[model samples]
Target chain A: MQIIFQIIFSLFAIAALGLVWRRRADGLLSKHSALWWSIIWLAVLALAWYPNSTQVLADILGIGRGVDLVTYCALAFLFFTIFRLTIKIESLQRDITKVVRRDALEKNNI
Target chain B: MIMILVPAHNEAKTIENVVKQLLFVGDKVVVIDDGSTDDTALLAGNAGATVLRHTLNRGQGAALETGHTYARQSNADFVVHFDADGQFDFRDIPRALASMKEKNVDIILGSRFLGKEQKIPWLKRAVILPFARNIDRLFGSVSLSDAHNGFRVMNQRALNFIQLTQDRMAHATEIPQLIRRYNLRYAELPISVSYHEFGQGPIGGFRIVRDLLVGKFM
Candidate 1:
């Protein structure tokens, strides 16, 4: 189980690095993206490599277990991603509405 | 010119009649057919209304915003946001306009709770309405007798400030909050609205609450 976890964390770090490179190549990566992907994933890799470190951090945070702390952190990240996606979708909807409105107005112009 | 905006979704049956009635009262009547699969746009256009269509069904609030945008661009003096369900009396429109003029107010909102002629169903009046009223009170400082009533008229000043963002039924709640936010002078006049089969019942109330809760984040 520990070996499997280590492999998964290594793969996630590689994937995050790949994404940052792709985004940078496309000129779509902001400073925030660069920092978030690099810093967070590197930190995650560190935690995965030294599993005992999570327990030390968890103890400081008053969490019962290292796994529980990791779970909470994962959940928080998932929620933040969901929130960002929702806002993006809403903005796209507004843009579509603008285009539709413009077309409708031109069609019915009198 | 007075621009009457009717945001319709699959309202092919009543759009013509609503547009015609509104045309009689206002200078120009425009229908924002919110992606109706039926002949809503065609019928409304044929009935002499400037029809706008959404490619996808966004919602009533979005349709209303589209109509308002067009109205503003056309330099409309006053904009009346009417329903395509044919529930409101067109006769009251002139009265609403007159009241706005008399009071020198920016917005004239129709209130079924304020008038005797309106026969709102018992469940809606007793349960859904009071709940909505309380929610509106909690959301904003603006106090209105009927917060969900769709019949409303806004002058240029009111339209310029209040930009609706909710794409669904939550716009009703947002409107009152806007009045409080902008500190716009508004009056609630008693008006009659008929309960239709699709627009009434417990399901409708549930839907309203659900959409409003969802609208909080958006």
Candidate 2:
């Protein structure tokens, strides 16, 4: 059963890597973003193939289990991603304001 | 070239009167109708104000920034930011400008806490404003008597130096911070604010703080 689960996880990681490659090819993802996604999925693939590999690092970090360490890292990564997206949205809003402001000023030229 | 910049959003009920009252005190009154579904732009235009319309409902801060841009382009010597809800007294416009000159300051902020007492709501007068003032002091690094008064007069130096990027109510706090950072001379003058309704409750205060924190840390 454990081997079957590992195979499923590895297949999922490979599928995600393929999706990332297709997106990068289509110019939908920036070069840096595609590279970052590729690295993340590659790490996931390594963990799926060697499920016990995380145990050494987790034990060094004082975490009880490898799976627990992965969960904690995933949550931290998600939070950081959210923070970056929020900042991006705010800057985009400011840019939109600038465009709208310029348009309004131009139309009402005195 | 003293221009009064009024940022209005769906305040058609009072925009006309506010524009006319401002025109009485300033050379030009420019009302930025902030995507109001109502006839705010039309009424302000009819009332002899130079009306600038935003196609979408960008918050009050965005509207005020647009007004500042207009004032800058028009080569305005001074600009006064007045509320569109008719809460502020137009007669204080000259008083603020005069205070700016007498105090040798570039910016004069209207303070409800100064001079005579105003008819502010009890909750705001007691809790929200004081809390906001402390927060402004912490984040903006300026200790002000009234931290969020909409009525302010700024000279050419301030006009050129202060650029508002906060696209919401947080601009109030941003203004003082800019004054401090740019080393612009500023003073607080006594002004009256008649609260017809409860303005900016505790929730609004929290949102301003949130925006300030996000803009600062994020």
Candidate 3:
């Protein structure tokens, strides 16, 4: 339990440090997809706590109570991915509006 | 009036020199200090350039968008994107402006590869150049080289048409697609590149490959 706590604590602590030093750490998230980045960090967190959370996650996954850790992680990742896609869709809407408006204005001038 | 836009992040060490060089060209300079923790904005302001700040570090595309918005609001004729890393040449600014006058091209791209003695990194030359050309070919684009070259001169019409939203290093890739989509007249002029300075090394080719694949599918 203590080791699990330490692992989770340390992993987040490192990511926190990374967030703090992100400006200096160019190309860390710049290279990878934000989805994969989120998945990676979350997976690390799950791996750290799996020994404790497995039984609960297993019940949730429809398997033995010990295998739900991966399931829960995947479900959580899927949710986060949907959220990311929603943001992208919103941004694309704004961009599309801008394009439409500007194209109209340009056409009027000619 | 000319408005020079220098999109910067954590470029305190080189911002002042770039600002001074831009001022030497007798053009009004605007430095987009994209949430640099360092004194990039302060030093740029002290060096006599108007500095704008983004509270959070957005990508280069965002910085360029900020500059474009500001320049358009201020009724700027030509908005030139010069690098804050001191890799660009100011002498070519007049030539770009003149090219706009002569050829009626809306966007002027500075090409490091087109010059007689180009100094682009080998990885960029070998991998990225071909990738860019291929991407252009796939889009049925002709008459543009090194679309991802950060250094560029964009006019008011081009700015309105080319909405840069990639907001990161991908903005370089975004410009060509926008140009093609909007049917904007874009031309490339040779510019010198010297990537041999301190802290310059080739990034992983696989990392670039990953970005390419992700951008393509996404």
The candidate scoring highest on DockQ is 2
Q: What would the per-residue lDDT of candidate 2 be over residues B1-218, giving only the tens digit for each residue?
A: 89999999999999999998888899999999888999999999999999999988789899998999888888999999999999999999999988898999999999999889778878888888889899988885578988799999999999998888889999999999999899999999999888877878888988888788779864
Clashing pairs in 1: none
| Model 1 chain B weakest 10-residue run by lDDT | B197-206
Q: Write the per-residue lDDT of candidate 1 for residues B85-197, one digit (tens) a residue.
A: 88888998999999999999999999987778666677777887788788778767389888678999999999998788777777888888888899999999998788774
Q: Which candidate leads the pack in TM-score?
A: 2
The digit string of per-residue lDDT tens for model 3 on A1-110 reads 57867676667956854663473366555534544465566656665655556666567667765645566667997997886776676467446534543442343231
The Cα error of candidate 2 at residue A14, in Å, is: 2.3
- Which candidate, 1 or 2, has the higher TM-score? 2
Ranking by lDDT: 2, 1, 3
Provide the lDDT at B74 for model 3.
Answer: 76
Ten contiguous residues with the weakest lDDT in model 3 chain A = A101-110
**Candidate lDDT (C-alpha), each:** 0.85, 0.90, 0.71
TM-score of chain B of each: 0.94, 0.97, 0.87
Candidate 2 Cα RMSD after full superposition onto the native fold (Å): 1.5
Candidate 2 displacement at residue A7 in angstroms? 4.3
CA error at residue B38 for candidate 3, angstroms: 1.1
State candidate 3's DockQ.
Answer: 0.04
